[model samples]
Target chain A: VSLNLAFEEAPLRGSISFISQSGTLGNYLMLLARAKGYSFRAFVSSGNQAVLEATDFLEYFGQDEGTKAIILYLEGLQDASRFAKVVRNIVPQKPILIYKAGRFDVGVRAALSHTASIAGNDRIFDSFCQQVGLIRCYDPLHTFDMAVALTTQPLPKGKRVAIISGGGGYCVTMAEAACAWGLEVPTLDYATAQKIKEILHPFAPFPLNPVDAASDVRPMTYARVIDILMGLDYIDGVFMMIPFMFEFQLRSAAAIRELVDATEIICGLPAKYGKPILGNMIPRVSVGPALDLFQKAGIPFFATQDESARAMSGLVRYAQIISLAKEVPFSAEKPRFPRADQPIAYVSRVDPVNIPERD
Target chain B: VSLNLAFEEAPLRGSISFISQSGTLGNYLMLLARAKGYSFRAFVSSGNQAVLEATDFLEYFGQDEGTKAIILYLEGLQDASRFAKVVRNIVPQKPILIYKAGRFDVGVRAALSHTASIAGNDRIFDSFCQQVGLIRCYDPLHTFDMAVALTTQPLPKGKRVAIISGGGGYCVTMAEAACAWGLEVPTLDYATAQKIKEILHPFAPFPLNPVDAASDVRPMTYARVIDILMGLDYIDGVFMMIPFMFEFQLRSAAAIRELVDATEIICGLPAKYGKPILGNMIPRVSVGPALDLFQKAGIPFFATQDESARAMSGLVRYAQIISLAKEVPFSAEKPRFPRADQPIAYVSRVDPVNIPERD
Candidate 1:
């Protein structure tokens, strides 16, 4: 078979490069990336992996200056030791985010049908990622979110967050979600409370950490609430839920765009002060309006507030990890192909003897 | 086939009645409702309209007196005139809110395949609903929102709305949405603005209509914002977007509920002075913890701010029709089977003429 080596000069200089054994998963991820507006260095469908291996590409991407992160959508490992070594080498220079599919019986079945290959146990891969400093993204959205967070906000010193909103429930949800994500929500001091009281309502109460404003208020309340929350001593970040003004109209497309742009600008302001602003402004009302705003602004806004908050949690956790430890890069190793004499069993584990006896 | 009529018994009073063509959609709605601590009056699947039709069940609920409101998951009409007639008949005596499914082509296909029936054009259904008194809900969430709105709040007199929020974008969106929905957002006078400024920020320009509190200085900010906006002239309703508070801290759930309840009490205070609370209080946060508080206090809280606003819009539109029209009841017509003995020939519009026309 003849093939074109497309890259002649400065090969692997640009784009996100992903190697996956399952083409269906690769296609799904590609579609998701396109929908979420994620830029890729390259996405290669590594079918069979009989010749070119995953480690070969990892090593190549490890030194490639253009590649900021390498994401893997793995069904199973061809060689576990080589995989760990390659990821270790890449970590010091760039982040290695791993998403291992085929972890369950159903996933294994799907992978078998898609790639005609058997999946191995996931515990080994999970341990390998943890040891090699790979940032594992549980979902596709989270993968993009981590990429955006690393590319945007500076890693936080700690996980202490304060939520400010026009509604109390939203603030509480944010606080609860933050705590669930290992962040803290401390009470404000009397002095801080008094300062906030000057600008807020007397009945509104001071130290309203997650300020929940009423419905009859104007949009300016969010800006003020955010300012007050950011002023707090313990707050490392802010998660606010903003409304899509145009969605309420549901009429003019122009109105929705304007709302999205203005929303993006206002929400993006917190980042100007170097404070992480995790906003829940899902364009679930209409997908077309604020999608470009999210993509262009490099924010992880989704179609649901829950999704936005969850993505924020992922980024927050990954940010904390990067702050705690330095990851290693893959060692310089030569590629190894499977010997022709050895049988390459596709249904490697489903055989009778290999089946685990479970209670 | 003998079927149990236990769902029709008087003992099942005060429970939710669910009717849907798609079992999955029905199941999802049921799950959401159950999660919200609501019990069902009856959960019936109106399969293909070949047996028990939507009109039949709606009419039964209308006169039953046990059903607070009749909810429907409609895909298409088996008989348009019969459905319209039945809806108009039951609407005034009972609120029939519908979660119409086939809004888009994909939705139509899904509806069709799910029920093994053709979902008629959505445009026709939209026009038919407008002609009659049917309340159209955007999604499953909004179906519940509209139901709560009708059950809790009194019928609004006019389209004038008062929007309260903590964010600029949220307020603007609310204002634009209100305007688009043909609701009036009356500007606040200088006096009201001045009083509000005493409690709000200097830069928090009370854009007259959307009462922007501008900051989360305290929980009192919540009451003050509502008070100022409600006092404005010509404002008949209010739509508020509260922050997600409880999601952040479970300990703060009571505090958050107190904050909302206090706001509602303040809103009710206007009624003591003869200016009745005309609008709705839609807290944008989810009702996971504060559901009991909201239900008992009489403030309609919605999970999403968008859904809340949309429900208010629906209520406003509904009130307009109610004022101009009479109450409608469900149809008494029954589905008639086709002729017992007839040649079933496949007919085509392209060949309208028979052999008598040409050959």
Candidate 2:
């Protein structure tokens, strides 16, 4: 079933473990996912699953201590109920992302002949996925994007996102996207705002939720503001919109040194305080030492505000799922799809009883 | 207002003309948009607009024959009604994109001090944009993505999109995005399906709405299949999902030659048949000769399925806006918001009478 199966290792050893249903398709997906600045510890193409089903691979990856996250590129499943049971047991430990192909009529036909299965043809399967707390990925390639944020950064206590960018444009778009994606962009407190304002340029506006520093704001100032936001009790996540066109701006060694220092300072903030900090470069840039150093230090930077906002929202959703799972423990022995209104329409709510005040 | 504004030219002269309210921020945006495989014809930093307001610059770029598309980065407008009138006139000639920043309380505070206008604060502004046929951009960077598709590709006669990809997973994800964005992925006609099925590999399945040609589809077969789809009366736009890990595969000169030939063949199909052909590289690839050649041919390629799908939808929405504008001519004399249910929630629909049967 795996025709001409090939796999490429990521830049460095990372936590994600990928399992694909098709050999050629899955391996190609890995090559694409790696481009998003994520590395994989292992890749398994369980084509046809003749010897062992997809569930077995899921269970294996779930137990693997090295794998912090598991990503699946599935066409169809032979026994979905078993897969759900296995996924339920692993939700508390790690986040599992599934990109199921052949959902539509034509795609179903392709999957039928290609993989000889119809598990993905039904709508109930998706609700089952939600019930079992399996993250469903719309864009197959973006599956890794959420994984990068989920694995590297600490889970936020709530779905509250803060934006800090030198460009007012980036701040506006990032805040709008965050709000659109079910994440709160609450206004900063007076004391916290004043603390951040002092670090910004004198002409910069009061540190609102986005904390829009002036265009001339330095790298160290950006990092300091991020540190302040991450330390706040109300802020669950921070999206740092860094300056773009660094390749042109980095004219001398001094500029490069400052960038490296800023990267070093910003990268450690995610782990310093227990809230996730996602970097969003003002514009969509492909390469820069700033990005390289940050990614190496385990801080993922997105090219666009939409992506950065969506990734943070996914992280928040993952936390909510985990919290929900805890409230209603899974019955692995029996797998049943609740009525459409029951688990299918699950909304992300800030449950203080379910989520701890802080990690 | 633009402190230390420095601009970098794109690799080549593209059709987009960018106008930024802040010189420094605007120039940086142009540099970033260029990385997405789009070049710019002009970049204007309309700082403060002490004499010439943003609307005046918009009027200038609209008249410039070299400009095929106009992208605006405006935090506030001194004259919203005047801007709306200018945009209405430009919409029929060329697609206009606006990335209006300073939406929320904090962003508004920044905008208030930075430029001194409150046009963006009201919800009526967005409705005005819709009525005026101005394409509102979400992600400042992705505005270029939609612009690339709009400027280079022909206006589709309908909102029917056909996805042809080497991978089944790409087809599924792309189809889902297309549908979500208010485009149709109709089943192919019997005769056309048979013709496409014959061009695919022997094992390749029947060409459905998304002709999921099996793995190992050659460049020539892909090009030929695209040509057939573009020629069909039913298909409006085409999403070509190219193979990934090409850097590894291009070890042989023969492989490179095939890609070059394929690129040449596929690039001509869009313009020849008067339809948009967008490329969705399987994964998120930053660099590739295939992408370079396609983009150079005026066929823009996106890095991910999400971008590819949304961009095509944007293109269709632009066409729909133009169609709607024609049906209900704009009254520049009276500038007022329509009823909340009027132009506020404009959904894309396939109106046969409004849309020409074929161009």
Per DockQ, the best of the predicted structures is 2
| Candidate 1 lDDT by residue in tens digits, B45-94 | 67566778878877777776556667887766687777777777776666
Give one digit per residue, the lDDT tens place, for model 1 in A107-179. 3433443344556665554444545667654343346555545554544545566655543334433454444
> Model 1: residues >4 Å from true position, as ranges?
A1-19, A36-41, A64-66, A109-113, A116-118, A201-207, A216-219, A231-233, A244-273, A284-297, A327-359, B1-359
Could you give the CAPRI-style class of model 2? incorrect
DockQ of each: 0.01, 0.16
Give lDDT tens digits, candidate 2, residues A182-233.
5778888998888888898888877777777878546788878888888888
TM-score of each: 0.42, 0.84
Interface RMSD computed for candidate 1 is what?
29.6
User: Scored by CA lDDT, what does every candidate get?
Assistant: 0.51, 0.69
